[model samples]
Target: MDVSQRLSFFAALFKVHENPTTGMWLLYITIVLLSILVFKLGFAKKLPIIKSAVIYTFLILGCTVLTFLGVFLPVAEGLVVAALILIIYKIRLHQEKKEQAKAE
Candidate 1:
């Protein structure tokens, strides 16, 4: 298969193979930021400072692996989609609650 065809969206956008260090780091940062946003918006629950720190530390470590997978898979793209879906769901949920409050 063609290399261009196999590269993931962010990978191709950053030209990972062409720029090696810079591109890979940029791709990795993109994946990490997206993953953190998704986790905060969709999955995180309030936690104490230490616990939150630990969780994020592990999450960043996990993103390193994700960065590798993201080169060929749509991992970052999937995270972006997931984050958008969560944002929409949260907005709708908040509106419903507000409407119910007003009706009460």
Candidate 2:
């Protein structure tokens, strides 16, 4: 192949993925991490897990409602929301134990 053709072939091989689904999934994960960071920084005095969970759930639910209003796909929104809920639940459980310890 000519140099132009060879260069084009290599360029195609290095091209970024254009899959909207995959990109959306990645965006969801990034948002989750950002939410976690926000909770960590904002509620450092609280139980780590509890703060994380509350922030995560709130953000996820907000995102889900937005998606329902035709912002994104249901599947993507569901997965992200589920993740957020799970994180919040874990944190809440941990906080309960810590509070009990304080009481005792």
Candidate 3:
């Protein structure tokens, strides 16, 4: 299918066209929240509030642009899913390392 058709397919999957702005906002929020979750669980325990705000703002903008361009729907979803899975795996590995240290 063409780009518009592919985008429409994803939009239909998520009912995005019913309320475009709301759909965009929801997608932005989802990306920000997932990114924060991954960062907190696998990388840093704390982020400066300003730094966090800036990062999320840029993320939302970037994702929104990509979404509007009709290129982000499928690929971004897959990337987010993969990132979440990686975050989970990293957390499990860290916990195992801690347990090993305790045993040792």
Over all chains combined, what TM-score does candidate 1 have? 0.95
The runs of at least 3 residues in candidate 1 whose Cα sits more than 4 Å from the true structure, single-residue gaps closed, are none
Point out the worst 10-residue segment of candidate 2 by lDDT.
7-16
Off by over 4 Å in 3: 1-5, 8-10, 39-47, 69-72
User: What's each prediction's TM-score?
Assistant: 0.95, 0.35, 0.59
lDDT of 1: 0.93
Clash count per candidate: 0, 3, 0
Top-scoring candidate (TM-score) = 1
Q: Encode model 2's per-residue lDDT on 1-104: one tens digit a residue.
A: 44323222212232213454554455545445554554454454555887757866787766544433322223344444666776787789899999999999
**Model 2: residues >4 Å from true position, as ranges?**
1-17, 47-55, 63-104
TM-score, ranked from best to worst: 1, 3, 2
Tens-digit lDDT track for model 3 on 36-93?
A: 5655555654678998788767766676665664433564465477677877898899
